[model samples]
Target: MSSSSEEIRLAAGTAEVGVQPGNGCRLGSLTVDGVELLRQGERYGSFPMVPWCGRTRDGRFRNGGTLHQLPVNSPPHAIHGTARDAAWKTARQSPTEAVFTYDLTDPWPYPGRVTQVVELTEDALTLRMAIETYGDSFPAQAGWHPWFNRHLAGGDGGQDDSGVQLSFTPAWQEQRGDDHLPTGTRVAPTPAPWDDCFGMPGGVDVTLTWPGRLELNVASREEWVVVYDEPADAVCVEPQTGPPNGLNTLPRLVTPLEPLETSTTWTWRRL
Candidate 1:
């Protein structure tokens, strides 16, 4: 709703998204019915989707029986991959398109380089991040952490009514732990204070409908959705390839993502 400055604006129907490139990635701002969907009040910046949100014990990981140390960015843990703090090179750009590339062959803590492109189209916004291994090693896990405000979706902002209502298919419901991690085992009942990831069947649409016909739907290519409902005035309907911290658990849980391999596409559209 603010004056378009340096941000690239994409328009389709009545929906619009503004994109900015920096910090190794592209950040998007979506608006519908004159309300902003993504949380702009918080610091808005492009962040990488690697090294995960947390680190292994002691910031060390045993890769092929060798120990590697990653710099601790989040006090006791490494946060949000290496690109969150790394500068991304803008390879291509226009009024509505941008491509950012990051080479981490030796400078990065890991042994891979990534090229992420953020494209803004009329109907939706797409971010495609590709990680290619420089050597034989592979990446552990990767994902995007974009914040959204429910108030923009039509929440009344009343004391009791100003919350988000997430609509999922019958088979998607599952429980999670306190750290917002899934327990693998399924629960028959959906618990209160729910903060977990559900299996999002591909092509299944999940909608966040607000009061005034303002809604956002994510059609997943993967099979899961990470629902993060904080005590704040927003909800994060993240489309992830696996659950949070799935890389650091017993039996290894989800398979460790390999190089030249990509997670599924997470696409969002305003309705």
Candidate 2:
């Protein structure tokens, strides 16, 4: 185990994870049996989605009768959230786990504290996030955006498979409009190459298999997940508390007494 201001490394059994607290508290790497499961680089890796998940319509939301506006980082919408652009502080740490926290400020309107926990074991990695209000209550969401490598490439990573295959049976896929926001419809599960959200009221259970190389399952208690497999080199199985633009469609309040929390876990096995 090694710790620094920028990142923390945790290892247990055959797994190792590198967490970057400075860069939006994202996981820099996940290497198991020498194969790097996560896509490397700053924009890649697994990052905790807090305060809100996915996008917020036109970067605006309402609390009571007051309407709040957020910076439109993704143009017409505010993708992800403010928490991922701010640095986080390490609250606690160990050889196989760590806890990080950051206070919500500016652009976000309401004040709140977000905490994230990352734990690693031989075969599984668990991630947890919570948003606690510091003052007035506000609508929010939480989740994770993990960029997984589409193909195994290093250590014993030589493989001939084209890419990892996603396997899941989502009850219904949120109808996605041309503008990329859910059109307020829940239709049957559509075809893959999806960059859309799906409903798993039973909880999110999706698997990624790389032929005879590896197999990983991304699971969460939350019922929503955004599967983005459009990229050529990376695939994202984002398990979130709500759907895209959920703040307007499905608001979850974070009051002083009632905090908003969510979690997702990744369990793997060598194939």
Candidate 3:
């Protein structure tokens, strides 16, 4: 039952992944065949978004007849979810797989348990999450935010690819408003450096290619993916159940009978 002090490392085939249950059950590293594919460092890496994903507009949301206020961490809105900010307990672990769990508490206005499973294969990494409620039904969302390296080792191709080029065909892009939240308008796909959300009704399928190096494919059953490539060193492809401010706009429920769940997988090939 050791927590934070222990960092779980999973290795398989040509890939190695580091999981930090101490720091929000996030994937701290991803290295494939001596090539680092994730942005290194503490602030980066891949983290889970549970109970709710993306922003909560002004840090406020109404559940049933009651309204709850959450701390504004993203300035002007409550971004991500509480799970990413809290440490998780190691529920189980193996060589190439691990399970972590945490309970939902105050400020979230719900009673639930969040469980995340990380499975790494020789050529792929799969992540799954579920939120089971202990009390009244409440709105919730699930997702994963991975900050991929804009430039992998020897993947230098200048500005175009950061050595990494993004390729995806989303059904439509969720038009982002000045507030950085989806305006509920679906428009055609736009260009890069996007802080925008896109819809993929047939599921999310995005690829990042590093010329002559590697190609990573991010796929999920979820319909929404947020592409944020504004940072100079990294690009984020987030797969979630809903868009930002979805707590008020989308509001998927987690009940005693049905839990909220979602998963995303990243498969790669050396080219």
Q: Which one wins on TM-score?
A: 2
Query: Which residue pairs show backbone clashes in model 3?
Result: 161-164
lDDT string, candidate 3, 60-125, tens digits: 999888999999989999988998778899988999999999999876888899999999999999
| Winner by TM-score between candidate 3 and candidate 2 | 2
lDDT string, candidate 1, 1-271, tens digits: 1122335555655656665544335365776545566776424432345645333344555555566666655556554566655556667676555666666643355566666666555556666666666555543655566666656543464433555566777365655654334556766637444566666555435677664445556655656555666647667665544455544542121222444323333344444
Which sections of candidate 2 miss by over 4 Å? 1-5, 154-159
Q: What value does the lDDT take at residue 215 in candidate 2?
A: 89
Better of 1 and 2 by lDDT: 2
Question: What TM-score would each prediction reach against the true structure?
Answer: 0.73, 0.96, 0.95
* Top-down lDDT ranking: 2, 3, 1
Q: Quote the lDDT for 142 in model 3.
A: 92
Q: Where does candidate 1 stray beyond 4 Å?
A: 1-14, 24-28, 42-48, 53-58, 72-76, 105-108, 153-163, 170-189, 201-205, 249-271
Give the per-residue lDDT digits (tens) of candidate 2, residues 137-170: 8999999999999988845546556789999999
